[model samples]
Each structure stands twice: as structure tokens, then as C-alpha cells.
Target: MEISQYSAEQIATLQAKLEKKLGPEYISTRPGPGGGPKLTYAEGWKIINLANEVFGFNGWSSSITNLTIDFIDVHGENPPRYNVGVHCITRITLRDGAYHEDIGYGTAENVKQKAAAIDKCKKEAVTDALKRTLRSFGNLLGNCLYDKTYTEQVKNIKLPPVRSSTLLLDVL
Candidate 1:
């Protein structure tokens, strides 16, 4: 969430890298308003959704119904950086073709403690959601950057352009 720690270009590059590594079958980016780039959560979900998409083993639709991430607050006095973070509920719903029949919800706050100290309720919400989704749905996360499968998958992918920054490496 610390914008000062990373340039917008760095963020874009990291996102592009993730997309390339993860494959686009179950992931895609939503363009931002100013044409600057895609939103961060939109970028992050390329892997997150892919992981959940494998849940069809039990007759449940395994695709994310929705996902949202946003900068909740900025902390630190001298740095004036983004510290506190929140993740809006990233939802995965079971569907029957066009009509969704069953609903299950997970939030980062549901697993991790809400960032009461930094006011990062949303960030907590996402972590919690991911944890709960994995627990409830069984670990179905497919080839993701962190997944062992991704290292091999990357070789098959053509890397995309990106800016460099350690902040972007935090998720790794």
C-alpha cells in the first residue's frame, strides 16, 4: 500500500510479470480511469482467482465472482507513505452456468486480524478471505508466482515489461 515506496510504473511492471507467469486463462486486468494502468488488486487477482478456479472437483464453480483491493490509509510521519492497507472482500461464488446457485464468502479480515492499529481493515479482509477460501474449498490455487508450479510455468511465458522496485517484491 505504500505508494511512496514504489513508483506507479514499478507496480505496473510487477503486475505484468505476474500475469505473464500466471497465464491469462482465469485472470485479466481492469483498466484504470486515467489510462494509467490496471488497478493493483486487479493485477493481484490474476493468480488468486486461478488458484481458486480448481475447486470444481466438488461440483462447485471455482471462479472468483468478485475481487477488490484499494489503498485504505497512509501512515508514518516522516515518510508519509502508504502503510495501512485493506482488501475489500474477494468473493468466489458457485454458479450453475449463467445463474449462481451457491454462495460462499471469504475476506482477508476473516483470517487475519483487522488492522486496527493501522486502520487496515480491508487488507486484513483479503488475507482472511484467502485463508478461509483455501480452508473451506480445499487448496485449489493453481500455478501462481508463489506456487511451485509457477517457476516452471514462467519458462514457457514471454515476460512482460515492468518497472523495478523492492516494494513489488514484498508479495514474493
Candidate 2:
């Protein structure tokens, strides 16, 4: 996927926002495991935590029980081709036993694709947990993202606390 060239103005805007939200510890484009420009996995998790808080992705017990990041060798050279980019594999398990293992890339296109799957997992976990946790025990199955049928059930939900997994499956 092609990285978009950011305008100077856009960079400035993003810088301002990052500075405000990230305080002094934020570092952009640090060296990743695959030698790409990105934060260390641990650092990236901190950013993820912040986003979850900001977006109120605060429901259900969801954890990345397993995560693996590696470089896919495209050519069979002696040392092998590496860092063409990285693959981030996440095995997410929800409290209600609804889970999925999703594959994503740091690239723009794949990131967008993975994000939708991630959001779906979030919605499924939350809705399922609510049913299990609530007194009335209602069915909340439907597509997320403004699907009208599940609106009432979703509206009555109170987002639960979030806990992240520490099971790192990093590979070289």
C-alpha cells in the first residue's frame, strides 16, 4: 500500500494533536521489528490503549491472547527478503467465547481492512457480554455500524472495562 504524502499543514495539525494527547513520551516512526518506521510493539500498544479510551471502546472483556509480527520473505535470497513491511496477526478472544484471529499489515490498505474486522470483534464482544451480564438477557446479534435492528439493545448498553493481552508472538 502507498503511504500518502502528508501536506505540511496536515503534518502540523497532526503534530499539534499528537503533542496534546501524547504528552512528552510520544515518538513517531521508531524502528519496528521488521526494520520499518514505526513504534516498538509495546509502544504501539500504549497508543492502542489511548484510542480505546477515547473512542469509548470500553465494553466487554477482550484480549489479544496472541499476537505475532513478522517479515514475509518475498524472495528466496540467502538472507531472505525482509521488511517489505510487517504482518500483524492478532488472536482476539472475547468474554462470551466469540473470537477471531485477524491478519493485518502496517500498510494503509490492509490497516483499513483489519480495522473493520477489529471493530466487528469489539461490537460482537460487547453485545455478547452485555447479554450475559445484564438482567434481561436479550439477543444482540446483527451487523454493527448503525444497523438499525440492534439499535435499542446497543443503546441500553454500558461499556465495560477493557483489558489488553501481553502475549507477544513477535518473530524475526
Candidate 3:
């Protein structure tokens, strides 16, 4: 992945805006191994929206550069399965003469029993690749979702104190 065109300050500003836009609703908890809490990620629509806000509508474009499928051995009593891998390249142009390109890879398995397995795998691969490519832009769009340790750290991070009266007034 290429380095981000945006500077640190610009990325920080974008991160703050994204945090405000995506509130607690974007975060979810799941059951991890040993009955521990696990962090779940929201969809990538927010990232796309933020990218559009930061850059113009045509600032970024993603397309599948390559795709391949490999057939695996069929197991007993199971349908034949194939592994599909997709390579996606995304280009983000913040402005004239300022741009970056990033490549992301995604793989998914599809079984013959499933109808439209190839299509489903392709969609999953595309989404995964997009998420990975977007995450290359640092934490602006909740990149912590890809990092377990960072997710835990974020959970422990303290929020600024809020005035109770201000909250009450807003509610009233």
C-alpha cells in the first residue's frame, strides 16, 4: 500500500470527524473464545462516506485488478469447494498531482452446494479488499477494527468528562 497523501494533522481532523459521525452504534460486542467479549466491526459505508466528504465524489476509485479460483479436493459427503482470491487496487486523489494507490487481497471459499457461490465469493472478496485498502489510511475510518490490541486499548481509553446539567438540558 502506498503512503497516505493526507498529512498527520489532516488525518487527525478526519479521524475526529469520523468518530463523531459514527457513535456507539457502529461498535458491537460479540462472544469470543473462553466467553470473553470481542469487538465487531460495522460496515464500510461510513468509510466511503468520509472519503467522499474529505475528497470529491471522484476522489477515489476501486476496481478488481485480478481474480483467480482454485479448486480444492472434494471431501467425502461434501460438495466440491473452490477458493477464490481477488486483488483490488484503489486510487485516491486528494487533489491535482496528489494521489496514492493501494492494493488489497481477499480470499473466500465457495461450495458447489451453494447457489451463486461464485458471485457470493466475489462480493465478499470485494468488500474485504475495500476494507483492507481503506484501513491503509490509518485510523481515520476506525482502522482499529483490524487490530485486536488496538481495539482493546480503545475500549480502555477514557472519554472526556461531560457535564450532567448540560446533558439534562439537552434532553429536556
Candidate 4:
């Protein structure tokens, strides 16, 4: 459905839902290297699922607006390991044509093949950019995580559980 089909009430409802704080349960923490502050994040798959839940599959879309290999390094000649760095800018657009864009960087180190490193770097860059772009939509899409003052103690209203499709599950 187009943005025109979304009645004001529907738009208001979606806005309310998007404004809600993200649930703490959706976050995951990993210990940083060298005992630094733990790194916290919502996984890529979870981010995608949240987008589907809040926006309806047809309500929003994303595109990699720009992508390029920032650098590539190949180590020792025989069966060289390749290290590649990629950069991407992703744009997320609602059916209304409102959009947000964000940049992301991805690096692949110690990859056995040049092609493999390039592939991994590109995918990672796109996913990173997509996640960064989507965060602008609201906390449920993970904007809260970026806020230094955000507290996990604060609760988010419970949203009904959603059943994800088998295809999406398998593909992810």
C-alpha cells in the first residue's frame, strides 16, 4: 500500500509504536577486547525482524546508495590472505518517501581468497549501513542503544509476539 492509503490514524499509530523505547531483552553484549567497555548491539537479523514488525513489509524499504572498496591488502604470495576494507552508505525510506541515510565501514582480515574477502567486506558494509540507517526510524529499530544516557532499567511497552516466516528464518 502507498503512503496515501495510510490514514492519519494509522500513521499516528505507527509513530506511537516507533516512539516506544526499545526492549532491553533485544540487546546483546559482548566483552570488548583487552577488557575494555563491553560492546552492546542488536544483531542484524533482529534489526531486520523489528523493521518488518513495525513497518509492515511493504511500509518501508532500504537501498545501498553507495558502496566502494576503501582498501585491499594481500599478504604473502603463495595462497595469500587478503584483507579488505569496504565502505557503504545506506538509505532507508518509508512508503511516504521520508528517508534517512547513514554510513558504515566493514573490514575483512585474514580471508583466504581475494574474492572471499571482498564478498565478506561488502556484505558486512551493507548490513552495517542498513542497520545504521534504520536506527533513525526509532528505538525499536535500536536508536536507544546509541544514546549514552539511555537506561536499560526503563521498560518498553510489550508488543505482541510476531511469527516470522520460515523463509526469512532459513535465509537469515
Candidate 5:
């Protein structure tokens, strides 16, 4: 999506705020099945809260627009595995009444969890879709994680120790 000049400015401001609030520890790195490192969701509520603070309460929203499920036998097991995929749309309404909407897609396979395969797959797909949608917002919310080099670099960095006074519960 083409971001307007105003939106770009807002995003830059938000990026600064996010970097100050969240540290490298908030980014997760995992080895993909193919041996390449991948960035995974470590914490998502932080992004939601930051977005609310930047855009105002309820200024942003996301919804799942489509979902599909397929049963496949990866291991030739008796019980087929369910693979779920979802498409989601997220929108942010700017203060000036203009809006930006983005679409994200995600897929998840059966996790071997009990009888809750459907539920688990659905939840995983939704979370992945939301993460992708938020990443489309740019560098503010861990989009840099998409870069393998960046992910490798940050994987070893430690987050600063939290001071008692800076704790969210303490602030509350």
C-alpha cells in the first residue's frame, strides 16, 4: 500500500516511541525447519498497546476475512492433520480522517495437540495473520525482524533490566 506523507511522518514518530519502549528481548528468533533463522512472535500485546497509544483508543482494528482448513496425512497416520489458513485485514484511521488498510495471510498445521487441533490451528493462524498485518506498518513493530541478518544480530542482545519504578504495575 502507498503510504501518504502524513502517514509516513506518523509512522516515523511511532517507530521512535516503540524502540524506546521495547528492547531486543521482545524479538524472538527461531530456527526454521530449513535451518534458516526466522523471527517469531514473542509478544504482540505490546504492539497493540503501542498502537492504541499512538493512534488513540480503538483507532485501529483487525478482522479475519477468510479462513480455510485442509486435512492432510503427513505421516500417513490414521487421523488426518488439519492445516488452517486465514486472511485478515487491519485498518488504522488517521487523526485527519484518512485511513490505511492492509491485508495479511497466515497458515498453521496440526500441532499434535489433543482433540483441539482445529482450535489450536485457528488461533495460530489468527495470531500469525495479525503479526503480519502489524509488521506491514513498517519498522515500528518488529518489521526489521524480517531481515535474517538483523534477527541474528538482535538475538544475542540483552534487554536492559527493568527498574522497579518503570514497571507497568508500579506505574499503575
Candidate 6:
């Protein structure tokens, strides 16, 4: 959506705040499949907290517009094992009417229960899509992790935590 609806000064100030480097405290690394390189990211809750920090708790919202099973494979008959994959698209809308959307995928492998696998994959997919869509906002939302150089420079720089009570007061 067009940010033109917002005043230039308002947009610039918001953009600058969002563009600031995300402190390393919000970042985490997890082991990747096949013992490959570790995956670095901010947890889903961190993204939600960052949104509240930058946009105000009531300033933005996200919705899952689409969700579907990308693939399902069931095999091994004894207890029945299955693999599932899910895809979802999420939209993030600012109170001002500007918006962004992105798709995310999740997979559950070798699970013994189909229903549980689907549930797990769906939640994972939606969370991934929410984070991906929100990342469009700016670096604090995760856009910087995509930039290896910038990430390398600030990867270890941690900032003090943003207390939710302080944020709530700001909303008042």
C-alpha cells in the first residue's frame, strides 16, 4: 500500500526508527538440517515485541490471508507415519493503511500422527509468514539479517531490553 497517505515527516521519522540496527539480544541461532550452517533469526515473540516497540501496541495488525497444505506423504503402515508441509501468506497493515504481505513455509517430517503434524505445521507456517511480512517494515523487524555485511558488523552488539511496561506507558 502507498505510504503517501502519511506525511513525509511522519514517514521519515518512522522509517529512521525502524531502520536502526536490531540489537543482537533479539537474535538467536539454531542448528540447521543435515548439520549444515546454523540458522540465525529473531524468535516469533521478538518480532511481535519489536512491532509493539516501534509501531505502538495498537498501531498495526496482521492476518493470515491464505493457508494450505503444500504436500503430504504417508507411508509405513504399522502405526502410520507421515510428512507434511504447509504454506501461508500473511498481511501486515499499519493503522495508517499502509500494508505488506509475504509467504512462509513449514514442514513436519516423520511424524506418527497426521492431525498433530498438520497442527504443528500450520502454526509454524503462520508464524513464519507473520515474521516475513513484518520484516518488510525495516531492519528492526528483521530486514537487516538478510544483509550479511550489516549483520556481521552488529551481530554481537546487544542493547538493553525494551520493557513492555515502558511501552504500555508510551501508548498512554
Where does candidate 3 stray beyond 4 Å?
A: 1-23, 29-39, 72-115, 147-149, 153-172
Pairs that clash in candidate 3: none
User: By descending lDDT, how would the candidates be arranged?
Assistant: 6, 4, 5, 3, 1, 2
Worst 10 residues of 3 by lDDT: 67-76
TM-score of each: 0.26, 0.22, 0.55, 0.81, 0.62, 0.85
Q: How many residue pairs collide in each prediction?
A: 19, 1, 0, 0, 0, 0
Off by over 4 Å in 4: 1-5, 151-172
Best by TM-score: 6
- What is the C-alpha lDDT profile of model 3 across 47-130, one tens digit per residue? 677667655577666655555543333333555665455555555445433544555555555556433555665566566567
Q: Give the TM-score of candidate 1.
A: 0.26
lDDT of 4 by residue, 92-133 (tens): 988878899999889999889889899999999999898899
Q: Which candidate, 2 or 5, would have the higher TM-score against the true structure?
A: 5
Which residue segments of model 5 deviate by more than 4 Å?
1-22, 34-42, 72-115, 161-168
Best by lDDT: 6
- Residue 162's lDDT within candidate 3 is 77
RMSD of each: 18.0, 20.5, 7.8, 5.5, 5.2, 4.3
Lowest summed lDDT across 10 adjacent residues in model 6 is found at: 163-172
lDDT of 1 at 145: 26
Question: Local distance difference test, per candidate?
Answer: 0.40, 0.35, 0.57, 0.84, 0.59, 0.89
Better of 2 and 3 by lDDT: 3
| lDDT digits (tens) for residues 1-172 of candidate 5 | 5645356667677657645423575665566677875535546676666567766675566666665554433432566555555455555554454544555555556645434665665666566556666666655565666666666666678777988877657445
